[model samples]
Target: MILAATGMRREARIIARAGLVPVISGGDAGRLRGLLTAQAARASAIVSIGIAGALSPELRVGDIVVGDRVLIPPRNGEGDHPQGGGGERATFGGFAGPSTACGGPPPRDKLGEELLTVLPGARRGVACGSDAMVITAAAKARLYEACGGTLPLIIDMESHVAAQVAQEHGLPFAFIRVISDRADQDLPPAVTCGLKADGSMAILPVLAALLRKPAQLPALIRTARDTDRAMRSLLAACDVLARGGVGLADRG
Candidate 1:
């Protein structure tokens, strides 16, 4: 079976058409580990799908990224507590750069030979996942450098967990992330500010909040348009590979 992860409800809403109800694991490595620990052996393939911010200008909003490696920072020392210490609630967001600073090991490559045949234009990239999404020039630069200057075609929160789980179970895994924002862009603060803890977009509240900043409306519209395009592209890619039994990436 294919396992897909979509970070937020909006992103998840898009994949509903795939007729695959994504398992809502909240994107925490610990939580994901537990879920997969039991079922890992049964899963045929794992996929992490979601929206990510672009760390390089070469990638535009709405472009797609299919990853071969996933990087996640390790958790802080627990001191034998096993849990607790007031960490952020289990929520999915974006990539955290480097494993040493946090607590995770280096990314594991688990993309099997079969899936690669489906991803044609996927660039070889090390996708880093973090509790927090990387934004701003400094953070992006740090992650970019950590990857040895190879521009990240995509970044997301759940790919690392999928990769780790696949590794533990010796399963084939691949990550497909659609770019919702570019390197020069940040999610309109207003949109995120109105979001509740449960990942639902507070549309009216967000709009009310943004009413004062008419300047952002244009960009928001543009992002919406781009995101729509990306979604269509993703489904097209999936259909071409999943139904036709062809691996697009094999051409690479």
Candidate 2:
């Protein structure tokens, strides 16, 4: 079976298939790690598929990014490490100090390259995992500058955990992310506090936040619109994967 890890329940629902088990993290890194650990034994390969915030200026909402490698923040000791802010710069072990690469080299012969093959317009780049949401355009810019390179960068909550688990279990891993927010966009406060523990939208909290600050409605609407576009792109990508038999070929 293929293990598909995602941050939100909606994404999990999108990637669900006959041979794939979708795990939702609900935006919690510890929960994600634990879920992947429990599910890794029965899986052949792992793929992190969902909507992600873009850190590259050139990327737009609805664009697909295939992760060549995942840049995860360095852990201080063990257990679950704290999520870093977009402005808080750190390198990965091989590249710099704030983030570290998980699961060796890119999976060219595996799922990563195959995704690009199927989605002809998709771009291959680095995927950065953050425990916290990278909400601001400035934060995204700082992260992009700190983790300087030519390759495009995208940030999300689940890819690192998926990559780590795949490495531990000797399973091939792939990352397929659709850009939900661009580098120039700042996610509204209401949108950030909108998800429930189950990864579903928390309507009450969103409403409360908006009541407290009505000015956020415009930004929230834009975010919602962008998210819709991203979801459509993700659905299309999943359809392509299903028709191409991308993750179903090797059962391992």
TM-score of 2: 0.86
lDDT tens per residue, model 1, 107-127: 444353344556666554556
Cα deviation at 250, candidate 2, in Å, is 2.9
Model 2: ten consecutive residues of lowest lDDT: 73-82
In candidate 1, position 194 carries an lDDT of 45
Ten contiguous residues minimizing lDDT sum, candidate 1: 76-85
Judge candidate 2 against the unseen true structure and give its global Cα lDDT, from 0 to 1: 0.76
Stretches of model 2 off by over 4 angstroms after superposition: 17-19, 73-109
lDDT of each: 0.56, 0.76
Candidate 1 residue 196 Cα shift, in angstroms, is 5.3
Best by lDDT: 2
